[model samples]
Structure formats: C-alpha cells, structure tokens
Target: MKEVFLSTRDFPVDEKFGLVSQILRSAYSVPSNIAEGSGRSTNKEFARFLDIALGSAFELETQLILASDIGYLSENKLQEIQTLLQEIQKMIYSFKMNL
Candidate 1:
C-alpha cells in the first residue's frame, strides 16, 4: 500500500490546522487501528479495533464534506476522498459483522 498519510500532503497549507489536518488524522486512524487490533490475538479485541476504524472513517467523511463546503477542497477532491472513505467503511463494517 502507498503511504496514505503522505498522500494528504497536497492539501492546501491554509488548511494546515483545519480541515486538512482533521481529514488526515481521521483517515489514518482507520488503518492504524486496524493494524493495532490485528496485533491482538482475540477476535473480539480485533472487532473492537474495527469498530474504532469505522468511526474514524465516518469522521473522515464528515471532514471531507466540511472541507468541500468551506472551499478548502474541490468537488473532485472531496469525491475522491469520500470514495476511499466509503470503501474503508464498508470493509470495516464487513469485518465487524463477521466477527
């Protein structure tokens, strides 16, 4: 996988302490929690991590919407990030349901 966090580097510097940072933090949390949970041995514990990841995905979606509304991000950019967030949300949801 590419460095997902690195991909957010292009967000406008004006958003350095705003939507840009929030989106980055939220998106990274999803995968970060997944990896950390995977390190645990129990399925239940892993499910908990997946749940947190789902929340992060939702948070990212919200941040993206806000960024678009604030003109901090273009419609294309919002859609792209939203697509990725949706995919991650689906994956996390599936994992949680299965567990």
Candidate 2:
C-alpha cells in the first residue's frame, strides 16, 4: 500500500536504502504476489504465488526485528506493524494451504 510507503518515510535516513528499502519492498511483494497469483488461470499457480507472498511476509518480519534491534526503528513503534505482518502471514499461509 502507498500508505505504508508514506508512513515508513519516518524511519531513519540511514535505513532509507537499507532496512527501510528492504522492509517496504518485501512488504509490498507479499500483496503484489498474491494479486499476480490470483490473475493466473490455475489453482496450482495461484497457490505457488501465495506461498511466495507468505515467504516475503516472513522475510519482512525478520527485517523488522533487525531494524528494531539495530535502533533504526523503535521497539514500540514497530510493534503494531510487526503484529499486523504476523496476522497477514498467517492469513496468507492459511489461504495458500487451503488452495
């Protein structure tokens, strides 16, 4: 979402091209992959794409932790975002598995 990109601009400048970039890209990839997969004709292909999206969600989760640990992001500031990402990951995984 464009809203996420707008909000993440508040992250430290040092992370602009590092953690910030990684986090945004990975977060965006999850939904994008899901959409692209839905556009496919086959259930198998859609499931595969959902799996990739799920993986990206996990990747973003790790990056979030790293950013907070390294002080590029505040623990409290990222807590809600981290929780949301985990929820999305669970939803994505459940959908993918049911496919």
C-alpha lDDT score of every prediction, in listed order:
0.77, 0.82
Model 2, 1-98: lDDT tens digits are 44346557778777788878888989889999999999999999999999899899889879878877877667876687777777888898888878
Query: Model 1 clash tally?
Result: 0
Per-model tally of clashing residue pairs = 0, 0
Taking the tens digit of each residue's C-alpha lDDT, what string does model 1 give over 1-99? 133355457667777887667777887798899999999999999999998988988887787687668776678866776777687789889888988
Worst 10 residues of 2 by lDDT: 1-10
Best by TM-score: 2
TM-score of each: 0.83, 0.87
**What lDDT score goes with residue 61 in model 1?**
79
Kindly report the root-mean-square deviation of model 2 from the true structure over all alpha carbons: 1.8
Could you tell me the lDDT of residue 70 within candidate 2?
Answer: 77
Local distance difference test, candidate 1: 0.77
